[model samples]
Target: MKRNKRKSDEMFNLDDIKVYMQMSAKDKLYWLERVAKFLHKITPSKNKKIWERLKERGF
Candidate 1:
């Protein structure tokens, strides 16, 4: 038997967000860069504006 799951728009959990908010500045920057790099990789080159901007700024 299969179970059904209800989908909602709550993509982020408040508790998780609170923990992330408590992370130190260096940890926050590390996570931010990781997410940005992941986004750049997954997003198509044509839509990779952030990567292009970063390149222009000498990343």
Candidate 2:
């Protein structure tokens, strides 16, 4: 048996959006916060000005 893995750049389909839309408000907020934190952790802090701006914006 063989498996076909998805490419990293593949876009989410309507079904995926529909599933997300069906989630409760609380669940949606949880996921949003999780993604934000993950992005913050991965972002490089090469520019002090940008980091200060993000902090000022409450990111």
Q: Which candidate tops lDDT?
A: 2
Tens-place lDDT per residue, model 1, 1-59, is: 12334348766666667778889999989989998899877899776776689899999
List the global CA lDDT of all models.
Answer: 0.76, 0.77
Alpha-carbon deviation at 38 in model 2, angstroms? 0.2
lDDT of 2 by residue, 1-59 (tens): 12345468866555567778989999899989998898888888776579899999999
TM-score between model 1 and native:
0.62
Clash count, candidate 2: 0
Q: How many backbone clashes does every candidate have?
A: 0, 0
Report lDDT (Cα) of residue 3, candidate 2.
32
Q: What lDDT does candidate 2 reach at residue 34?
A: 95
RMSD of each: 7.5, 6.0
Q: Where does the lowest 10-residue lDDT sum fall in candidate 1?
A: 1-10
- Runs off by more than 4 Å, candidate 2: 1-10, 51-59
